[model samples]
Target: MIILKYIFKFYIPCILLITAVTVVLCVRKPYKKQTVNRVVFNERYFRKISGTEKEKYLDSIVTSLNDERNDSVSRDLYLKAGEEYYYLNNIRKSFTSSQIALNLSREAKDSSRIAKSLYFIGDCYENSQKDSAYYYYLQAQKIYTLINDYEKLGRMHFNKAYVLFYDGNFVECEIELTKGLNYLKNSDNEKLLYSCNTLMGNCLEKLFMYEQALKYHQYALGNLKEMKKNNLDSDEVNNFNVSSVINICNLYDLKGEYSKSIKELNAVLTKDLKKKWPRLYANVLSNLAYSKMKNKEYKNVEFMFLESLRIVDSLDYRSDAIYKKIYLGEFYLAQKDTLMSLKTLKEAYRSAVEMKNTNEILRTLRLLTKIDNRKKVFYANRYIDMIDSINSIRSKISNKYARIEYETITVEDENKILTKKNFYILIFSFAAFLILLSIFGFVYLKYKNKELKFVKQQQNDSDEIYQLLSEQNEIINKAKEEEKNKIARELHDGVMNKLYGVRMNLGFFNTKLDDKSIEKRKEYILELQNIENEIRTISHDLSRDSFLEGSDFNTLLSNLIANQKGLSRARFKYIIEENFDWEQVQNIYKINVYRIIQEAVLNIHKYSRALNAEVKIQLSEDKILKLSILDDGIGFDINTVKKGIGLSNIKERANSLKGNLDILSGIGKGTEIIVMFDITR
Candidate 1:
């Protein structure tokens, strides 16, 4: 055993060293191989390839990437591969790469990358799984909006609109396309603008607005021309131009301008549309043949129709093929071949039914009924069933689309909540805490500034009211001083002289000491009593104009009611709480309260036509001031009688005082304006 241990101890270190070296070489060998082929595997060189080769190379690159990485580079690499795969018509692989990218972007919390990843995933599902594609596009749209990426957001809108168009919801498709254009208005992306315009033109054509459709198609061609100046892909620009031309020609055909349609189609066909876009080329040919057939020029029309059908069938475009068959059936009917027309219409009807295209099926059934009279009842019933099913299908599609949007919005809300929570947690970090502190300080300052502004405005209003009242008080004071001087003169010139004369008469009576003198003294005493009565009358006159030394409202409010009584025949009365001190009220509160009472009294005088009016003011123990202005006049219906400026001013003053006002009135019921305020607050 010792011999075996010694041998292990000596050779184990050598074995361990050699094994570690071997493992290191094995681990790095793939990396070295990657370096040698970096020109091919590298993302930096990805732009060097195209078509099927590029898609295959992207798949290989994705397979070779380290699965453990969750970084921006890896995320971007996966996103690029996914987009390339989608362009190459490999949606399954595209979806896989986009999903990985999405996961990595989420882990990294990268909003822009996440949006781009979701957009690619949406693109992958756009052709087959429209609802899913719409949902993903909506999610991406939300992210783009949050990040303020208008270009991508506009693209998402158009993609979603295309999905709606595919479902035959032309109205909604037009609406979304319009919104997409608004977002792309400021974008320099001419290609996407061209796409949006072309789709918009198609929508208008479907709605049968031929003239407006032509205008949009013209706009689309204009976009294509601008795109060409930008050095956009020649093939892409050609495709867009062809699409616009075809749409314009279709509109012309709808307008019964078949020669115009044929001319446009022939013009676009010269751009080698067949080699570039086979489906659009077939579409152009089909429209050209239809236009020729409609214009009564049947030269090579059947051959062109057959050629278009051959391309569509080879491409397995079932909807296009169905439409072509229906057109051919119409041609046969024009030729008076009723048997062939009925057979063709029947075949088109079956194809449309298999495709679940309700409108086309109804149209084909209608055509079949016209030709095959023996089966008219059958076709009619089938047509009604299809019409009913169409409503159901539209309802189902609407619900499905709405549900998808709802789910996307719900998930976005949840993600926002989670992101906010993460942000809150991040606030605990030192730098974040500092940032938060600065933000708090700024917010606090803003709030304080607003409060200060409000307070300053209130102060200005109070000053204006105070200045006004001061002017009123000056007038009152001047009148009071003049009245006081007049009363002083009356006392001095009238009462004092009479009293002096009475005293002199009394003295003269004292001088006489006989019977005649006694009669004179009685006369003199009677004259003195007359002088006393005159003095008392002058004192009463003085008291009417001036307030008492300690009294305030015995004159101010009473004087208000008294003056209003002169304007209206209404007998005015007022009440003030015994404990309330007018001097202790804040100016803002005091002036508003004064103005409110003034306004209410004026309103009653002018409008109420009441025989009696009362102003009651009370202050509770907790400093709550309650005021009521009541009138017993022919009352108005509050709802019927709109509040005039007087009532509005009263309410505004009450609000300025931070008080609640309730005006209760009904026909034949006296109006009562009740106001309450917490003065201490």
Candidate 2:
């Protein structure tokens, strides 16, 4: 199936080109429009213009392009403007101009320009600006499909793979990357092929498909070799060669072939490419050092790691430098150099924490655990804490994906019902045609039969639609119960375990307290007590009993506000009207409301830069809960700001609860969120 897809993808462009030729041959007069003078200026002029001058230049171009008298010229101008803005990293402006270009191209029915604009839009979205990156990539994918532009289609799929990865959907990412490779299989575009294979290998590795990943990396290497053979000495080709080599080395390291890995790294180094590519060199050195460390060549590993560290430090790049430090610490730990290992591992651990490298931190913590018995307890506790936190996050991501799938299936079922209904309508029309032919044989009899058939068909259609709706509702109910269980498990297994362990640790220390040591023990006890308090705060609100009883709504809100008050400097103003009938609320609806408010308040406190905020919950007479959350802050335009997981969570939860949520905010204006949901007794 996959090979067939590749073949079809390759042939689609040729078919499209033939169709284009046929259209052009059949058509007589082609419309001609005036070319815009604005298209003559390049990105260099925009770069030369400073501050307000640059803004003025852009503004004049936009105004001139907006002139209704110059539609074709306007489109060309917009495309040029978009290119300039894209170069400047002004993604918002670039996206706007590209969208304008797309609109114009669509209006003109120009397939080539439409494809080009879509490609630019995809590029803009894939860059730093985050809003609807996936959406834009998907849009570009559809446009490329229409134009049968396989190269752009492959690029779009690759970008979608990245989005899936960031969303923690590694399985989906690997699948999408495979689709990308299939789309580009027969293409002569060596750069695109290399990129697709490398990314596929990376995602496969992340998914723990080591053998498959190595195969893809090797495939990429083969392409690079072919490109070289073709006499294309592009820097891009060189970069791909180096990357494929590194991926191959890493795969070997994972496979426990440390010796072979070192050989691959050495080969890259022998190419004299180290000086020209410091980052890659540093990474290669770090990997080679790790391989040596595993092979028990302590002295050699030390020197190699130090070189990598020095290079990374000089280049001011800490990503690989942190890895080198951790490896060096591991080497010292293995040698039983306790003092040096402790100091080195501690620094490495700090760097890992600062860099947010969970894997490195986990490794360093394990090293710390194997050191002196005195600090072994602390290190062991930290290791367990990190593991639990990771597990909790994994569980959360799984639950989110599961919910997304459930909702998707529900939509499919609903669409199926609509399709079935249309089918029945078509059948009814065919029956009417038969009746018209048989009208002479039986006039009133034919009419009676037709009416009966129509009535029966309507009943069947209604039954099917009703059945689908019921099934959808059942799926949603099951998902809610599962989600509730997952949340409970996270609370009990994660936060509760840490709190218990810390308290137990403090209890053990309490027995050995001397006069001076008593203060230190008490300090540790205080820290543990604070952690316990936080757990209790979260537990009290997240409790299954209160949620099931539906009496915990007010308590949950109060706890959140109190927690925020304790954690932040901003004053929190929370208001709940007396009309709130907690006892009558449904558990799922209550939980959804609580989570939405929790996410919203956290975002406001963390990112709003607000001094004050207000939250209001009111039970309306229509058996609905109306929540109005407001914040007086340096707000953002919802239309422009990219919605992340937290905001997505709020929206998703609201959808799951069959509620409506509207967000109103602009630059300097405060944010006001209104959520309304029916909650019947």
Candidate 3:
């Protein structure tokens, strides 16, 4: 019995322990084998895959490594898949794969891979989602900058600027392009540099900076010419050359040199760009047709338009087709073929609406209103509403651009300050070292050190003064440019459009001079009188010196109010503190105050639907200038309604003058704006 108990306890426990160890080993052996098999399979798969099989091979690898812990290999596989998908034009898949790669790279803390993945994702969305593309590009730019990857950084900036240009944000686009050019100054990427210059030219063209635009375009063209001379010719280089020619032609067209535009387009047409680059070729043809139309070569205009349309249709270029249809409609209208014109225009309008092209829709609507008088009122109302909405959106874009410019300038100024400080520190450190050496060598060196210190101090002072002068000059130049733009807009929208209306009315009156000729003549006389009043109002607004030379502050306010009353339906009243001396206020302060009031009144006239408005100006005994504008209009909710360009301008003017502005308004009530400035400050 004792032997049996010992055997059962000791031997049985030993057998159970051995069996547990065997079971654990047996379970781990298959896992190890599976891992080894997977690695070998991945290796074999990669080796067997051809370049054309990259996407398929990548997919298999990704699936096999989905639960694997090797992040580096996984991220690389995802990146390859993304690149292959991008080339295949599967942007959604490309974006998804790149995003996965980006996340994996981030987890791995791989900056280079992160940047590459971000750039790939940006490219995938560049055409469809501009804002998202810009976001990713900026993210990639930060990584590139951190890594000091200047080439990729320059490319990122260039890409972001292209998207901005597409959004019509030319100011910010130019800023970004300028930054890219600075980074690419010594880079050997001639193609990227050429692209940067070309895009900069386009931005400048849109901003109406034509001289600079032409210079940039010429620079790009010269680069291409140099590349050609070096036998570095490819389809891409040839296409760039063709595009540069087209851009120059478009610039010429914008500048009203239609003959030069046509000549350049003809030169482009001589190259056989049709087969290799059909879209570009079609664009050139359409531009050529438009230039010919503008030059009044009516004989070839229809044929050119038709040929361009045919090419566009063959390529299934819907956007270009929409514009082409509009051109055809215009051509038929000019030829007095009302039936064909209506047909083409309706089709164009439908296409534009479907495409969500606001500019084309507006153009089509206006043309329809002119062609079909039965629907004139309907189309005219739509046109006006669209114009207003477009204007509002453009105003917001301009504000955003100004903010970007200001922020860029601020950063530049800070960098300059930092650089100047570092330079001074170096000089001072050197001087101190020299003083220490002199202390050990010669007693006369003390005076020499003092002289050096004084010289350095003088140089620093001079540099500071120069910097200040430069900053002031920049501010003045910016102000001048803004004023010029404002004047141009006023002339174009207010004066020019009115004059065009007068001309059209005169044309109609001249055509219909039957029994109602006298009544029509009377109406024409009244329109001329209205035009004269408008001209007078503009003259008064521009006549600032006359009001400021010796006139009282009340007189200036009175003149502005009178101009508004003449130009608008709103009644205006002015109340001013007696015995206030406007001449005591600084010229700068007075100018900004005048502008603020002018902008506020204009807003009231344009948007407030106000019947009566009042202005109050007071100079307190403590030399505080107080100005208030009260309008009995259909007021807006100040908290809910975003400020428009006019209100923003008023606020900016107030800030420039070191004033406090308070705007109070509520729906169904009235708006009251009050501004206060301490002239003593």
Candidate 4:
């Protein structure tokens, strides 16, 4: 009733104005100048129409505006058309119209409008063309930054965070996404605030922070609903609310709560599906299929998948279709139709690879293995191979994330320190202000005999600031010394113990005599040989330089290989790509790279197996060094490998040098290690 009232109220005035104009023209046969004014006034009245009539009114306005060469009117009409197409999920057309709007905006030299248009263009490709979306988002972010429009910048960051999520850098992505949310928290921009909240919720859900995820999703939903209630004509509010539902549904699905996911999805279906939001419809259908499959409703699953595919195909959604095929392959595999499963899975894999969708590629590979057990051993072997390959990639990402986190934490810590410093400075300044105020007051009060009290208060405040500064300095010094001591203890206890054993073994061999018998002579000879190897090993361990001061690049590597002698069952080999003198490589990069490899090898020896191992280093044309340590043994799942102390240490060391490390391994196969870094002497 309210919607109808709104429509009628807006249109009735336009109709009355048109009728009055007709009456005036028919009754008065206006003078020539008056006729021109009437026509212009009547055309202006037509522009006041609303609802469906408003679209026609705008179109008519656009025609008249174009005839008058009104750039501003044309730009507004283009933006409206683009928005309508976006609402209808005519993404390609929306993109085209937005591009036209962007060109117009650029000509108008309106930076904000250009950024807004670029954001829409980014939205069009965000799901299917991630790289392109990221590029456009970056372009938009640049403009937003130039204009100091932080709200748009935050939205761009949110979009970039999603791209990173798709690229499989979930940790760093979470960081950036959180940064965006933080920005929104300080702003009142409705669109950016809602987007940041929803995307942050998605990120938290992916990280398994379900409760926090729900909170943010609910926050977004509540905000969106409030906005919608006040402004029914707002397409953004409608889309935002629908999107919140979709995100909640996805989160429930990830948590394996199929019923909840279905409930949310069904709610969206009843609300938005019939309202002509086709992309939203497709997304809901895809999610519904996911829940149904999870619930083992295979027949219904296939139906939903097909429905999603049909809709997405109609829209030429190449990536969406590929994903649906991935789901279908999963469904077929569940039904034990191996041939169909293999065919569908292979197609999905190819498409994903072509699109450079690493996550999808991993999924398809996993499903493909289930389709044919005859290929099981082969696939398992390859899966192990992929484990290493994927692990290496994952390791690089992990290191990147760790570095990002470390840098973030460092910045935060530094900020905290700075904040403390600022607080002290503020305290000092405030005390100074108070003292000056007191002095002024004292001078004024000297006439009234109150100077003593004011002077005493000033002294007390100044003393308090001085005391606070002293305490903070003492605390900082103590912390620094404690941290240094902790590091020293770790090195002494961990590495020194091993070195002492080597020394003891050498000492034992030095005392043994060979004069007793032939057997005694032979035993002594073997003992001496063992002692010599021990001495060499110890020398390698002790001779290595610190990462802080850097090591001799060539010697750092040779020492690494020699330390492997401690592992009884392993045989080691080294392959350096270049014949150039190892001294040419910088010391700073070599030690850290070697330590990363050392840590990986140590993990392998302790957990993988004492078996055949290989270390290869290649210096590429770009001065990029690739180092790998591979071992043939029982390899564990890299995905399941938690960032333990050793792995964390490895990653931290690698990150300090801005290098990359990759670990690949699986059960009964071998572990492959790869590290890459640039060398700067």
The C-alpha TM-scores of every prediction are 0.54, 0.51, 0.54, 0.42
> Each candidate: what lDDT?
0.78, 0.74, 0.79, 0.69
Backbone clashes (count) for model 3: 0
Please identify which of the two predictions, 1 or 2, would achieve the higher TM-score against the true structure: 1
Put down candidate 3 lDDT per residue, 1-681, tens digits, no spaces.
685456555654554465456546754633332232242235566557775676676567667656666456667878877887787777887888898888889877899999999999989988998777887788798899999999999999999899889887888899999999999988877888899999999899988788899999998987787777767867778899889988898889887789999888888785468877888888888889888887878877888888889988988888899988898898888889999999999999999999899879999998999998788889878997898898788787665534554665688689998997875565445445445433322233346667988999999999999999999999999988977775654554355545654565566567676868667657667877877776676555654343356666567668667655434568999888877777677876776677677777777877788889998888874578999999999899886898877787778778766788999988879899999998976
Residue range 81-126, candidate 4, lDDT tens digits: 6676676666876787788878888977878888888888988988
Mind giving the per-residue lDDT tens digits that candidate 1 earns over 193-286? 8888888888888876767778888988888889888898898788777777777877888777888888888988754678868899899888
Off by over 4 Å in 3: 1-54, 64-74, 226-233, 393-681
Q: List the residue pairs that clash in candidate 1.
A: none
lDDT of 3: 0.79
Runs in model 4 lying further than 4 Å from the true structure: 1-183, 186-192, 204-214, 231-246, 256-325, 331-340, 343-359, 373-681
Clashes of each: 0, 0, 0, 3
lDDT of 3 at 163: 84
TM-score of 3: 0.54
Error of 3 at 55 (Å): 4.0
Model 2 scores a TM of 0.51
